[model samples]
Target: MDSLKVKAYGKINIGLDVMAKREDGYHEVRMVMQTVRIHDNIKVDKASSGDISITTNLGFIPTDKKNLVYKAAKLLMDEFAINCGVSIDLQKHIPVSAGMGGGSSDAAAILYAMNKLFKLGLSKKELMERGALIGADVPFCLMKGTALAEGIGENVTRIAPMPECCILIAKPGFSVSTKHVYEKLRLNEIQSHPDIDGIIDAIEEEDIYEMSSLMGNVLESVTVKEHPVIEDIKMAMIDNGALNSIMSGSGPSVFGIFDEPEEAEFAMNAIREMKLAKQIFLTEPHNVE
Candidate 1:
């Protein structure tokens, strides 16, 4: 049996702005999400009886149809009317529900590997479109790089020559529920957005300072206040000389952006010494080698 392995890269929200809640029960969002070098490894093989089997070391994660990877494979087989079974083994290094879009990345990788293994020959655009059904961020992860996402996270606009930056991701021992975070949000609450124009300009000019200053996540307000330790993690990064720091996604994982790998490494070591979070990782941007 032939098998193929693919890298499932995690993502960081460089800038996330929650515009407003829509009638569809989802919020309108404007975000610049970049895939980082941090990743989970996935290996897929052909299965005999038209069954999907997923194995992972992370006991907390589901391996059944509830998993996004399983759903993604099912979507492709059903859509293209193909007949085959697939066995997916995931080396789940990324923390679950850590705001890094780990699950979404894995799902996207599964779709990509299956497409290639089965010789489906789907274009990148078609794969992204199909990926949208798996999750809001799955499509973006399908074509990893830098992208501006909107409209429940399905609308994607690509950005080229994204500056090289190092990432420091720190996940605390606890997890925050996305549902609870959204429910706690208040429409009338005072809100601020990252400098969208400044961020775009930074990407265009490849300016690290400008990019750092513009990195902000509106969801931080909901997560930080609930867990004071989250604020501590941000402070630790800043104190360690991170160029910019922000909480990613809806919860507990926080990332510090650095212009130099040395700076990011310093911050990672500092965070590790303090033992503030469950784990700390130093990584760089994703360009798909």
Candidate 2:
């Protein structure tokens, strides 16, 4: 294939737990990572220019080395010694810096597309291994389903897909840096951690209520402390018929799971009226099945 187009699906953290700071400087994290229906559309094709080029609908995003998409292409080109350049066109839907793993998802899509475009013949496991070099979250994005991520998120184990349900995602106008949240996190201050093992069991049984109720993020204390609006959005979602709501990742973005589709739509409408979320989406969990 000379070119490829794919949907770079975003993710939400069903439960995030921080263990301790490692000597390498990355935190030991245990989290249930979920792929959502929300995504960014990416199209990649070979170019004659002999340099990586990126174009995106969002102007504020960087187009150079700093961009994960560019980095992914560059990594493959150099590692494989591909002589041709690459052009990437991105139609971004996932909120940037919202803890949805948008950038990582895009990078994973590129890695998969480039492998096919160049016929590199790498397996999914090999691609995921390469993904870790780009970013911790990239491997999980490449995996794309329900899984438990530990060890800075590179160690992924796919669990059964999350219980089927309607999901409502809300992102306040502002974004938070994951680094900032991590830096501010004090493990000593945490009262309790989410029941990750129970969450996995809930997912296996397709028990949405048990799973949603168990969903939590340790970073919430940091992000919500900095921005109370996140909490407000969560409450709004729950008040409007969502079964449960929790912040996603090191987030400014919050997601609420609904047992009924009508409830989700209703929550979306009410959330829109409240004007708490800068960007609101009604979606569902995206599983490989």
Candidate 3:
């Protein structure tokens, strides 16, 4: 195929814990990550010219080498020694820097689409390996589904899909830098860590309530401290019929789990009316087929 189109899905961390600060300056983490239906549409086509370029519907996203999509294309071209170029068009729906893995997903989409567009015939494992060289979350984004992520979000183990439920995502008008959040985190001060295995078992049993009750993120302590609105969003989610609510990833974005679609819609509408969120999405877990 000369071209390919794919959807790059976003993710939410059901449980996140920092184990220790490693010598490499990255933290050791254990987390349960689930893919959501919220996504960005990526269309990649071979270019007649010999340079990589990107066009996106979102104005704020960079179109040059600084963009992950551009990096992904460059990586593929350099590694395979291909002389041809490609153009990427990104139709973004996922909120940027909202702990939703938007950039990583975009990067993964390019890797995946380029593999097909060029007939590279790379396996999923190989694609993930290539993705890891770009970002910690790229590997997970390439293999969209529920998984247990460790080793700074690079080591991923596919797990049973999350129990069926509605996921309501709320992002305030701010972004949290992953580096800043990690810098603020004091691993030694952490008193409790989520039961990662228990969450795995909950998914196996399809127990939504138990899974919701188990949701936690140690990073919230640091991110919320910097931006108290993160806590407020979580409280609002819980107060508005969410089975459980937690901030995803670094900060500034909170997600609520609801069993029924109507309940989720009600909560989403309530939050929307409050004008607390810059963007609100009523999405659900996506299981890779």
Best by TM-score: 2
Q: Write the per-residue lDDT of candidate 3 for residues 1-289, one digit (tens) a residue.
A: 7788899999999999888899989999998999999999988888889799888998988999899999999998998988889988999999899898999999999999888888888999999999999999999999889999999899999999998889999999988899999988987787778888898899889999888898899998898888888888888888989999999999778999998899889888888888888999999999887
* Candidate numbers, best TM-score first, in rank order: 2, 3, 1
| Candidate lDDT values, in order | 0.86, 0.94, 0.91
Candidate number with the higher TM-score (2 or 3): 2
Please give the lDDT score at residue 257 for candidate 1: 81
Better of 2 and 3 by lDDT: 2
Candidate 1, 1-289: lDDT as tens digits: 3699999999888888888999877888888888988889999998876888899988878999999999999998888776678889999887789888999999899989988988888998989998898899998999789888999898888886467877899999988887788778776784777876678779888887888888898888888988888889899998888888899889689998877777778888888888899978888888643
For model 3, the superposed segments whose C-alpha errors exceed 4 Å read: none
Residue by residue across 171-239, what tens digits does model 2's lDDT show?
999999999999999999999899999999999999999998888899998999999999999999999
**What is the lDDT, from 0 to 100, of the residue 258 in candidate 3?**
93
Q: Residue 113 in model 2: shift from native, Å?
A: 0.5
**Worst 10 contiguous positions by lDDT, candidate 1:** 187-196
Q: Give the TM-score of candidate 2.
A: 0.99
Best by lDDT: 2
lDDT of 2 at 151: 94
Instruction: Please list the residue runs of candidate 2 whose C-alpha ends up more than 4 Å from where it truly belongs after superposition.
Output: none
All predictions: root-mean-square deviation over Cα? Answer: 1.5, 0.7, 0.9
